[model samples]
Target: MSKNVPGIMRQKPITPWLYLVPSLIVMFTFIVYPGVNTFYLSLRNADNTAWASTACKAGESCWGIFENYHYAITSEIMQTAFLNNIKWILIMVTGTVALGLLIAVLADRVRYESVAKSLIFLPMAISFVGAGVIWKFMYNYESGTNQIGLLNAIITALGGQPVSWLTEPQINTIALIVVGIWMWTGFCMTILAAGLRGVPEEILEAARVDGANEWMVFWKIMIPQILPTITVVITTMVINVLKIFDIVYVMTGGNYGTEVIANRLYTEMYKSYQPGRASAIAVVLILVIIPAMIMNIRRFNEQEATR
Candidate 1:
């Protein structure tokens, strides 16, 4: 046993690294290498066969070596995509978190709790593309005919004109965000429900005993205790909304002012065959997402330390 101890000690450090070799190789090949390559491509031309033009004639409009990034920042389609993504981040994130928390709290008091939760979470089981397709039917518009879309049918039934839910630039983005909220609210509810379960029952009871109303108990004691969970949910929602693509693509094809960053990136890469602009868009997305990811990690670390 004594002789074996020296040999075991020698192997211990290397043993963990040996286990990590496969994952390291995979990460470098897929994540790190692609990330670096994308950055390199962003500096090149549409086909990535040459460096982007940096020279300009006196009268010509040009963006120099960063032409791709210039297009991403200033082009009309990219601008629309950026604004729409910002709207998504604000509205979709808030709606999901708010509705999810409300439903979680209310469901806890209901007799059929499991049934309610199951129904709410049902949408999450469907893929985003599937959900988008289902809702597209719900939002479909056909003029000079009987309303085929459920929403339009309801409006016509109530003596209102049929509304174009997926088009007409003013309301289109809002229309798409509604689908996002519907799909993700269930997820937020499930996570928050778990956090709610961790609140100390004794603390809640004591608050009530001290003349705290139900609202007071929820606002003061319960909310603070579960705040970290709420933070996690909010950050998760933000990240998801930032990369929103499938729903926009399936439902709107990014038409009628519904363009989002990811969809625009797809359009540049595949349809326009502009690899450089697509790569620049991807890099921009990563930069935007990193801060949220870092915040989430720090929050998680704090929770672990407390544990």
Candidate 2:
């Protein structure tokens, strides 16, 4: 038996497959099956009892096999939700990365750097639901009563009228995006801070020695060095913003024009009982996320190769 080592090596490669069995089983069971089922359900009617072809009733024009997908694309609510997700990607990602980078650079030069970073990152420890509820109160409005919400209280104290943070359609989505930015800025700061720490001090000193002011050194030297890290952060934020759900659900239940893709999926699935529509939304969301995910993977591979 001890002398069978060479013989064992010559045998079929079943050992690796055996090791992979459990993982493959788990992946198929949890990820693969659900994804396939979702796509399958997307082609059917609301409860999957009928083909999407029957979605047309008599005089109604039929969209054939992809009625749900059509609805996902053309429906007003879905269009609004899609646009909101795009808005989230634009504003929240920009604000998060910009503020994070600025704070990271400033914090690095400060005396209590650790404390400063810790305070900024504290919001990340809170669950999104919790953060939403906290901000909900912070944005609360009571017209007749004395303001209890912090923002309104401050505004009223300064002789300004209370602002409707959540109800107004014009600014509600922006309000939600603000909460997202606040919660995620700390995460961006921590990652960018690590990137900043990796910069070669000699290059920075040399640039300054060549008469580059701090601003010029930052933009010309530090930024280019950390551009990869910034790209990763931006893509990560994009993906996060695309699938934003918990906070929107907790705070507004996707009301007042704050709808996003994931929130719309939840609404269709649970509230409206439109499983087909929900599945269509899910598929669309996956498609949207794929590009960002691919970029992130490429960036990771490049980093690994350079190392």
Candidate 3:
């Protein structure tokens, strides 16, 4: 038995890999294969023709290497779409984290904390497409004596002009961002609230004894202790902001300067039948998401290591 111990240890090592085989197969089939195919397709011309092709599709005969990329970057609509994605990252990420933290902090001390959190977190339960549809009706414009849109109705009641919430570029992006914040703030709040709960009550009592004011307790003790949770929330929001599609698509169909990277990719691949350009956009989106995902994974590992 002692002499056979080494062989048993070797068997254990192989068993883990054997157990991983199914998961590895699934990842390769669903993720790795599609990813490689997308990159290869991105390098080809619009008509799916490689250098060996005798001819191209009728309208895309002129397509060549670098042609789709050039058009994707140079097109005015594409430029606007890229810009809109940037704006979303800036506004949505900041707004969601800030508002979520604020709500979490305030509600943590309230008598009806559970009720307050449940109300705030309700939007997170709804799908993004459903939220977009609901908001769309709320922003509907009509040239009439009365308006159903919440904002327009409020403006008219105040004897002010009704603004086109979704039609104008400047306001449309912000309006869409409001929807994102509404949907995600609850998620942030929930995570932060859990972190808040983990905070040692004894430590807070000690801070109070040390002459620390409520504000000081929050800034010095509460925030520092919850820093890890805050990082997790912000990174998660950043990833979501990068991949935002449903709201922009359902609300505007990438029109009126509300276009985003995902929307552009969908349009290029499906509507325009330009697989190469769409793939390029997809690759870019992946590149943007990879860093955020890495940060999240590292944070998670660090939390586990601490535990």
Candidate 4:
């Protein structure tokens, strides 16, 4: 054997795993255990009354294996929540990405880039629940000179009627979405701005030398170069959107036509005490996220390989 082989043999074989032992223990104790329990609970009835009290052959109506799924699919509020999630995904993703990219490009060369970015990214420091409470006060709607919400106050000052920003099915969903955009836009901006910086100055100057206009160069060169980062940001936002609960919970409590999937899961599990249905909803949500997560992982791996 080579001299190096003897030296390697002298080293502790479990050294690498020694470092991993703590992490592995933590994962098993927390993440893996909880995940397994959630799945196990999902298979049982709400309160586990279906299987625990009797045999698995409990009557069709008495013990339904797929009954939770059926209830989740058919429930009116559940349906509304799912549809609202779709809306949330569409509108929030579009607004966050569009605004983030716009601000990133505009601030890329500004003298006050740091200050501008700091102001925008400041919201990222606040918790989602904290931002919700801040905006809830902003959307408050007490009448007369006592108007508490900034928005209602502004409208009143402008001689317009004070509108309820967080009520009314027609507008409440939109109201909640606005808060979400406010909280997340900064995060998207930071990621996208970093991506923009990665695009070499030399390439941009070369593109200009070839007579490409500002818009053309942006569309043809800068955007293409930054596309990977954009994809990662989008996939991340999609995952966030899929699991969005805090804003809806704080602002509306999933009431007045503003329920989303995660909120529904919370309501089912905690409020309604319907474990089976809640687990079903959780499973459905996991299914929806699987594809987006797979894409994100692939992109991440590709980036790692390139680096």
Candidate 5:
């Protein structure tokens, strides 16, 4: 930005760019270079000795460059992982945001708002891995006297069978989603509470005076007023959902059909020792996230404009 001086605007020169040199250097070194290289590697065969081929015949190398992308798209495990990632986004984002908004609204009317909020938001203080570990113990399903998991213990006490919570594909996915929701709900509550606090008290009074019921006011007025905040929260949560790794990694290690994109990339790169496939997966993930990042940036700009 330039200021008008004596009816003339003067543009800054190389000095401004000079000031950006250090940060730009770091960005290019850490982000830009790696990103470019990842794309390059993604185009190479799984072994990276040559360009990838699309052939998938007998006695032929199926680890061609495009083969990784094809495998990612066609493999049963990859499909499961992709679908589970979608499930994660839907459950974690909606559940966390909805629960957070509910808590935020309730806290606003409570005398012990700070205490209630502190307790609810306390989970946000725990690391994702720690939260997963805690929940793992909670879902333990040891046999007989060795049963120590809280869930199994409670079930058994209620005269029910002790079920394996994390090892079963059908149940494990949902179980991991629950842990994600728990870890992130507090973050949503804190942000939305701030957004709610920013609402004008006078507007709320006006709505009340107009005979708007609490539910009506919440849905029609308060929510609309904080819509921008919700948009930001949703977009942030979506991004988080896409990169979700720690909780799933800690609790299931992508086992029993609980894999997500990041976890797959991890296994492909390290566990399976397939850099080309890993880079391809990375590229696939980056492509998926670009649109979301763009939308978030646009919303951010819109928010700033309003403020």
Candidate 6:
């Protein structure tokens, strides 16, 4: 009876993976499987016919690694798309974050702070595609009649020639950047305002007692204290700029030299019917965004650990 009791007392060892089964299954099905399939498809020829035939014959299709990648890099459209992406990142990220911070600071102490912020934040409520369409109408060009485009209308009213807003390659990029800034500035302001609220009033009062002017206090005191929030805002803006697709797609459709990485990917896959090339573009986009995301994660973790 003692031997039977001892045998029954022994319990089964716990399997660590038992707790992770659901998450593991979800990741495997959603992320891992799709990523592997995309990478495999990216190695095949443009039309996907060769890959389909090879798979039918031998249960697998494998073009040499980097062949599609090489083609994508060498292609003229892809090159232009890459350059446009760089331009978007530079202009959109800087403009939105800087302008948003300025506006946030100014509005914080204003008489009608809520009204000012609400008006600015209105654009953010609109979908990117919808905003693009609205801007497109506002930029419409006519040959003979007075321009209806808001910018051109003002120019014509001032006795200046009406310039094409979306047609001119150099100006078109800037125009698109303006739309992005309009849409995202509110997001930056909201985040920065919250950060501003977190600043201790006693510290600000101490600065005042030390005879620091408003400008000095802002630059030395407020800016340093809110640096973490600024980092997060800039990082978020960078990721958004990298993934920008809908506005450019709706406005220019990668035409008039306004091509971007995501737009180029869409054209390659759907318009040009080149799955391999599209997959290569997708992979490159993933590579570009991964570092930014990793840095943001690290910064967030560090902030949390410090807290």
Mind sharing the TM-score for model 2? Answer: 0.95
| Candidate 6 wrongly placed segments (more than 4 Å) | 1-16, 49-64
- Candidate 4 lDDT for residue 241: 96
Query: What is the TM-score of each predicted model, taking all chains together?
Result: 0.95, 0.95, 0.91, 0.90, 0.92, 0.89
Model 4 stretches with alpha carbons more than 4 Å out? 2-4, 7-21, 52-63, 143-146
Tens digits of per-residue lDDT for model 5 on 1-307?
2354653455467768989999999999999999999988877766778776743577854755477787777788788889999999888899999999999999988999999999988888999989989999999888784579998888888888898999987789889989888888889999999999999999989999999999998999999999989999998999899999998899889998889999999998999887877898898888888888888899889989998
- Best-to-worst order by lDDT is 2, 1, 5, 4, 3, 6
Which lDDT value does model 2 have at 76?
Answer: 97
What TM-score does structure 5 among the candidates reach? 0.92
lDDT of 6 by residue, 75-181 (tens): 68888888888898898889888888888889988999999999988999999999999999888777654787887787788888888888799799889989999
Indicate the TM-score of model 1. Answer: 0.95
lDDT of 3 by residue, 217-245 (tens): 99999899989889988888888888899
Q: Taking the tens digit of each residue's C-alpha lDDT, what string does model 2 give over 2-29?
A: 4767874665658789889999999999
- Supply candidate 1's per-residue lDDT for 120: 97
Q: What is the C-alpha lDDT of each candidate?
A: 0.91, 0.92, 0.86, 0.87, 0.87, 0.84
Q: In the order shown, what is each candidate's alpha-carbon RMSD?
A: 1.9, 2.2, 3.4, 3.0, 3.2, 5.3
By summed lDDT, which 10 consecutive residues of candidate 4 come out lowest? 51-60
Residue 67 lDDT in candidate 6: 63
Off by over 4 Å in 2: 1-5, 8-11, 58-61
lDDT of 3: 0.86
Superposed on all Cα atoms, model 4 deviates from the true structure by an RMSD in Å of 3.0
Model 3 lDDT-worst window of ten: 51-60
Clashing pairs in 6: none
Q: Report how far off residue 11 is in candidate 6 (Å).
A: 10
